[model samples]
Structures are given as C-alpha cells and as structure tokens.
Target: PPDVEQLGRATWTFLHTAAAYYPERPTPNQRANMLNLLHSLPTLYPCSHCASHLGDNLKEHPPDVSGKAALSHWLCQRHNDVNERLGKERFDCTKTDERWKDGPSD
Candidate 1:
C-alpha cells in the first residue's frame, strides 16, 4: 500500500515521542525467575517508556535501552534518573512496598 509506509513512519514517531517522559525508565527481572514463572510471570516492576527495566541496574556499564523516547530516565543519562523516579511516592507509593514481599527467602 502506498499510504502504508507513510502511516508506519507516523506511528513510529508518535510512539517514540510519547515514551520520552515515561516514569519507569528501567525495570528488574531475574531471568531465572522469569523461567521459573513461565506459566505466570508477575510483571511487578517499573519499566521505562521504552519497556526497559525502570532501575534494574543489572549491568556493569550502561544497560540495554530501546531506541524509544520513554528511555529518557535521566538527563540524557539512564540509571541515575530512573532510580530517583522509583524512590518517589508514585510507582511503589510506599503503601504498596510495605506489603509487597511476604514469606521467607532461600
């Protein structure tokens, strides 16, 4: 379709721009844990607009970030800004974390 290409480009631009101010820029998810919960994975983490972990910090240097606008966690940075957002009283909202984790650990 002739219009298909133009439409696709426009859609991409809209999506990219919207992600620019996403709150959760990064998230944390254990691969092993994901595997274990293959049947029922709990998406219990913040993610950047680009769908990256809000503040997983599961890397040595910078981390995997989609070329999306939501990836804007910091001032052209990543982890630092995302961390601050997570600490705010919005995502976790304190009221949620206080009762998030239950039972014991191994």
Candidate 2:
C-alpha cells in the first residue's frame, strides 16, 4: 500500500492532468460529473485525516467547475492550501498548463 504522501502526489497529478484536459467550455453534464468527482473525494479518499481536511476545505471553498481555467485555478489553490499545511513550497498556479499539460519550457 502506498503511504499518505505518495497517495497525495498521485492524486494531485491525476487531478491536475484532468483539469488540464478539461474542456474550455464544458457541457452541463461534464460540469456535473466533475462536481460529483470532487464531492466524492472526502468520502472515498483512502486517508481519513486527509479526507477530513479536504472536506473542511471544500466546505469553505467549493470546487469551481464553470470552465477549464476556473477548475484548474481552483484545484491549484486547493493544492497550495495543502502544501502550506505540509510546509511545502506552493506551486505557481500561473504555470498550471505548462506543468500539467505542456512540458515546461527549458
């Protein structure tokens, strides 16, 4: 079984990548599905402590699924919140596409 940190990193990678590929203007169904996925995390996530924290955060700042940019920024902010709690450096939300979609410019 993977540790909490490993699980978290993998989860974030999946989320960011998904957000990167998300349609610029998704259909109502796509938005609803995205909301469902985000809402399910607190209940389905393996790490109880992490899930609780995420649930609390979600209550304070719900997911923004209006569009690809909105969702990507929302997820980046959420990830930054976790990074702050863990004393990790915050990722630059501006570079989200580069990080998650296009390869970083060398």
Candidate 3:
C-alpha cells in the first residue's frame, strides 16, 4: 500500500499529465467526462483529510475544463494552494508546462 504522500504525488502526476494532453476544444461529452473524473477524486481519494480538503477547494474554485491550458493552470493553482497549506514552497505556475509536459532544460 502506498503512503499518503506517495499516493498524492502519483495522483497529481496523473492529473497534470492528463490535463496536458486534454483537447484544446473538447467536445461536450469529453468535457463532461473530464469534469466527472476530477469531481470524483474528492469523494474517492483514500486519504480522508486530503479528500475533505479537496472537496472544500473544489467548492471554492470549481474545475475549469474549458480546455487544456485552462485546466492545467487551474490545477497548478490548486496544487500551489495545497503546497502552501503543507508549509512547502509554492511552485511556479508559469513553469507548469515544462514541469509536466516538457522535460525541464538541464
């Protein structure tokens, strides 16, 4: 069984990568599916505290599934919020593409 931190990292990676590949102009069904996938996380995530916090965040700032860029930016902001709550340094949202989609230039 994965620990909470490991699970969180895996979940975020999956979400960010998925968002990175999401269509620029998704069909209505595609949009609905993506929305469902995201909205289900808070209820289905194994960690109770994480789930509750995500649920509250979702209520405060609903998912923006309009397109890939919008979704990625939204998720980055959400991740930054979680980082702040955990007393971690906030990530630069501007570098989300390099971090998630494109490998950073070494």
- Assess every candidate by TM-score: 0.23, 0.95, 0.94
On residues 22-86, what C-alpha lDDT tens digit does candidate 1 reach at each position? 32433344323322332121142222242344223333233324322324322134323444655
lDDT of 3 by residue, 1-106 (tens): 4499999888998999999889999999999999999899889999989999999999999999999999999999999999999999999888888988898532
**Model 3 lDDT, full chain set:** 0.92
- TM-score of candidate 2 versus the correct structure, residues matched by position: 0.95
Candidate 2 residue lDDT tens string, 36-58: 99999999999998999999999
Query: Which regions in candidate 1 have their CA more than 4 angstroms from the true location?
Result: 25-106
What's model 2's lDDT at 60? Answer: 100
Best by lDDT: 2
What is the Cα-based lDDT of residue 17 in candidate 1?
38
lDDT of each: 0.32, 0.94, 0.92
The local lDDT score (0 to 100) that residue 25 gets in candidate 3 is 98
Best by TM-score: 2
